[model samples]
Target chain A: MKVSRVASVFAAALAAGLIFLPLWWVFASSLRPGNSFVENLTPLSWRAFLPVGGSFANYEVLLDGDFARALLNSFLVAGVTVVLGLAVAVLAAYALAVLNFPGRGYVFVFVILVSMVPFDAIAIPLSGLFSTWRLSDSYAGLILPALANGFAIFVLRQFFLGVPQELLDAAEVDGLGRFGTLLRIVLPLSKPALIGAGLMLFLSQWQAYLWPLLIGTSPGKQLAPIALANLSNLYSVDLGQILAGSFVLSAVPMVLLLFFQRQYTESLSTSGMRG
Target chain B: MPTMSPRRWRDARLAVLLLAPAVLGMVAMRVVPAVSAFAESFNHLSLRTGVKEFVGFENYAYLLGSGEFHAVLGTTLLFNLVLNPVIVVLSTALALLLAQRLPAVGLWRSLIFVPAAVPGSVTALIWSTAMQPDGLLNALFAAIGLPKQPFLTSSGQALGSIGLMLAWGAIGYWMLFVVAGLKDIPQAVYEAALIDGAGWWRRLTAITLPLLRRPMAFVLVAGTVGSFLAFAPVQILTKGGPDGSTNLLMYDVYANAYQVGDLGVAQAEVVLLMILMAVVVAIQFRVLREERS
Candidate 1:
């Protein structure tokens, strides 16, 4: 028993260290000066994962460069996508789950199939079509493609199914129209699902690389990933700036995951394993 | 057929109103692009001239006959063949460990789970820097008195290194699913196994593995798809490498379309990739179903 307990503790620590170490290196490297970033890592010691002579100058340089605009674009685009995606998805999910409409089964099946079609596979032709319509290099180019998120609808519908049928019927008897019942009753009950669905939409847009790479090619239209990617392509690669940009790009999703830990886990547990 | 009542008419109208935006958006965006990709693969399109010429089987012939496409197909298959199983096994092990009554298990779980949230581009950036010759990974190797590795630089090891990077990002996320599956298993089964004097290994193989089949199947299929679609890491880290060693099919399609301006070929590659995915998913379902019965 004693031996097993010790072994389990050691395993936990090792697993945790594997993740924490790389992240700490990125965070520490982001703060350190460019030249010393490489120096600290060699002869690996605590100094490598710790801040030594760290400053905000790398961040200052990054923000002053095009990275700030890229960050803004990602935030703006992700924000719009979440609000619009959630509104669109929630309404559709409500209908699919609660209403009696002709061809409901077919519509439900269509949503599932849509969810299965990998976005990355279709991006090439989509980009060509977007550019032809003069939608490339605009916010519409970035946000429009992601607005119709079938995964969000699928998740929201699953949650809505769990709502008591009697409760919805009672609401109907109380003279609540379809929209009214959805807004007043089902919406309030489905907060966690809403947050989860919204998070899914937001993260997909925020981390989008290939679509943004294709459509948002102009300098003003560049998203965070593209901006960070461009840093290393320079003739003289700036390690500190790259690290700094990476830390910022990575931090948002991690923070969101932490903040909504319960809802996120619940969301994954319900929908993710279904595949 | 029954006559439509007033409430039935109201419900139908409401349903249409509620579903219209999402349905239209999906049809315009998801369904159209995919159908057009299949359609466009059969034609030669010039963006500048807005002229599309019908060229049946030519693009497919050009792509399939090319040595580069074959190598890309091989690399993609080899990478996923190695990557998916390694991830499933390692993550299952991690899930089993974390499921134990270890100290501060929540903290450890969160630490591991946090990386799944890191963006793919960010993962590429971090790993690209760390895998440098004088970078942090090498520094750790030096600390232990081991020889340094040319991780991303060597053609021989570059694909495996990319696999390792992807695995590192993927395992923790999949571990959550397995852990959830583990939770669904009744403790009574383990207790009964213990009463029968079954060893840990026996219990794992007999009880846990069999019961956890669904989640494992899910992890396998989803993880395989993810490996197939992996793009940002290759784009940022190698750009298909020193001699196209790291070029997977998705990036190959991107290179052909964007860098080389050959949409016809790219669409043909997309069609091939989607067909491959469909076949793989279908096989997985059949195999998993057969095992269950």
Candidate 2:
């Protein structure tokens, strides 16, 4: 029994290490000074484990070039998408959860149907239509199509449903309007849900590849992923720079994941039907 | 006016008022685009002419009869088939182990899950760095006295490499759901099984596995849709690769829309993918729902 317990512990630790090794490799490589390809490879060495002669030269190389604009574009795109997605989701969620009205079922079903249409399906026509309207290569084109997410609305509504009726009633008795009750009473309580939804939406947009690739074809306007890819192609010699930019691109979501992992997992647990 | 008339009317008005922005956003962005995409599938999209002209079923027919389309469809299915079972089984096992009373489980689980927090685009970048011809993977091979393998450069190995990266990121995600599912199971059931002289394997098969069907089904269905829509990894790593060996359906769709500048065929393929997703989602939901009711 003791041996088996030790074996299970060893196995678990091994699995966790194997899973996290690639990320560690990226982090370690990104921190190492440039032009150390041979030294970066050797296994079972401190050079492979820790940064030797570490510096921010790789990050400077990335940010001083095309990556600077692309990074800014990523922030703009993700920020707008989150703010817009949450704005619409909160109102729609409140309506669905707090109000009594006809055709709400139809509206909810429409949200599901919206998500059922695949990204590729929508990207084809949307790119054309936006180009026709002279909206291509702009933030509007990049962010508009993604602002309406059914999963966000669904999660927030589910969370809103859990707010006690007594609180809402008390707010109403205190002469709070429907909007006031929602803002003062309900919204504050749904912080975890809101944060989870925002983080997911923001992270997805920050990493958005296809939309920016297809629409923002102009130079210096691509998002981080597209830009990083283009940078690697343009400067394929610098592996360190590539790894550094990827690490930087992942910074925001990593922080959010570390801080809000519980809420993030909570959303996934309840929102199974989402894409 | 009576209190009922005023209050009911106000609530109804408020509902409509509140729902308007979200509904409008959905219609303009999601609803209208989808409906127009279906309409556009039968038309030719040409930037040179600046006007899309109706071309009947030509787009669908061309795609249906094309050899490239068939190859992409086959690759898509191959990816799903290879990825889904591995993901489900491994993640389930991980979840089962994590659910056990182990030391430092929280830190271990977090480390396993941190990979998921890395965006798909960055994840692709990281994997590409690792899989390059003279990359770390080959270095490890040479150290172990084995010949270097062409990971992303070889046609046959490209798709498998991408799948490996995806599975690396996905196992922890599916594990989260599985852990949640396991939490809902009663401890007494497991205790009773143990008291009846049942071993770990028997308790798992009888009590744990049966109870896990719903969350497992949830993971499978969502995972299938996600794997089908996987685009970033293929784009960043191989770009449909050394000899088009890694050209999955999503890449083909992007190539049609952006590379070839043919939205008609892209929309046509998108329609096909959506139908596939709908069927997969519907069947999974129905199976789980039936089991419950």
Candidate 3:
């Protein structure tokens, strides 16, 4: 029994190392000075692990370029989308979950069916509409279409369904109006679901490449992912600069994930399970 | 009873207040575009003429008749059929292995998940770099006394390489879901199996597999849907190159819309792709429901 326990411990350690060591190497290499990637390719020297020749020149160069503007654009798009998506999703979800209305099941089914529509298929028609409305290459163009996310509505509705109906009824009996109850009671109670869904939406928007790339063709309006992708010069290939930009572009979502890791994971799992 | 009239008025106002934003947004964004797309699919539109002519089923007929469209559909179907099952099995296995009471489990989880945080474009760039002739992967192969493989350069290998990179990036995220599912299983089941002299494999097959049907179903559907719609990696890495081996339906739609500026053809392809996705999702749900019954 003790031997088996020891074996399990060893196995766990091995698994953890398999995943972590490579990541550590990448992070360390990203922080290392020029030519270190080439230098550390072999011999496995101890000097490679140290910060003796490390510098933030890569980051400095990246931040000085279009990276800052792209970062801001990412924030603006994701931030606005989250606020708008949550407001709309919460309202729709609350209505469908709690209210006894005509065509409620049909609405639920429609939302789920729409959720399966791949964004790739829809992007062309969406772009055409944007062109007609003269909203192309604008922030409103990006945020407006994404605000009608079916996944958010579906997840939020499921959560609202699980909220005890007795609490809602009690609120109604206490002279609380529906909107007031939703604002004060239901919204407060559904914090976990809201945050989870919000995180997922924000992450999706932040890492959004295709739609943003398609719509935001202009330099100032492009998001981080798109900018990082187009950061190459006309002639020279700056590996260090590219790596630095990639790391910076990746940092936003990573930080968000770490902060809301629990909520994000739970929400994703719940969404999958429900689907 | 005296206040019923006022209460009814207030309820009407409240309902409108709650439903207005979402309904308006849905109409403007989803409903409007969807209707316009359906309308546009039946019409001829082009940048050259800037004219719209009604052509019922003409766009669809053209798309169906195109050899490229047929190839794209076949590629998408083949990619999904192969990629989805491979990812499901691998992700499930990884999840089961990691879900055991393991030391540094959090570290392992973070490592596996960090790649997911990387932008899709960046992932494509990294893989493209790694697939180069003198790249890290080739170096490792040479060190291990193996011949170098032209992973992305070869027509036959390009699609498979893109598929592998996608699976690598996605497996961790899916594993996280399966891990969540595995956690929900009670420990007592395993404990009971231990008392019955059941080995690990037996316990897994009898208890774990049966209990994980819902999550498995979830993975299957999600994987199929996601793979069917894959586009970015192909765009960044291969660009559907090496004689169009990597041209899936989504990329084909992209080329039709952007490259060729054929909105009608693009819309036609979009409609077809949606139908395919709907069919897959419907079949999956039916299978899951039937199994439950």
Best model number under lDDT: 1
Residue A265 displacement in candidate 3 (angstroms):
1.9
- Report the C-alpha lDDT of model 2 over A97-130, residue by residue, as the tens digit: 9987767788888877776555654666677778
Ranking by lDDT: 1, 2, 3
Candidate 2's fnat? 0.63
| Model 2 residue A57 distance off true place after TM-score fit, in angstroms | 1.7
Give the C-alpha miss distance for residue A143 in model 1, angstroms.
0.7
User: Ten consecutive residues with minimal summed lDDT in candidate 2 chain B?
Assistant: B1-10
Which is the better candidate, 1 or 2, if ranked by DockQ? 1
Error of 1 at A255 (Å): 0.9
DockQ score of each predicted structure, in the order shown? 0.81, 0.62, 0.46
Clashes of 3: 0
Q: Candidate 2: deviation at residue B183, Å? A: 0.6
The per-model lDDT (C-alpha) reads: 0.90, 0.81, 0.77
Tell me candidate 1's interface RMSD: 1.1
Mark the 10 consecutive residues where model 1 chain B has the least summed lDDT: B1-10
B1-293, model 2: which lDDT tens digit per residue? 33557777787788888788878877877666777778888999677987879999999999989988888988888889889878999999989877776778887798888787777877888888887766777777877888878888889888888888888878888899899989999999988888899997898888999899988988888788889888888887788877788898888888888789888888888788877778877987897889768
Error of 3 at B18 (Å): 1.4
Candidates in descending TM-score order:
1, 2, 3
Candidate 1 vs candidate 3: which has greater DockQ?
1
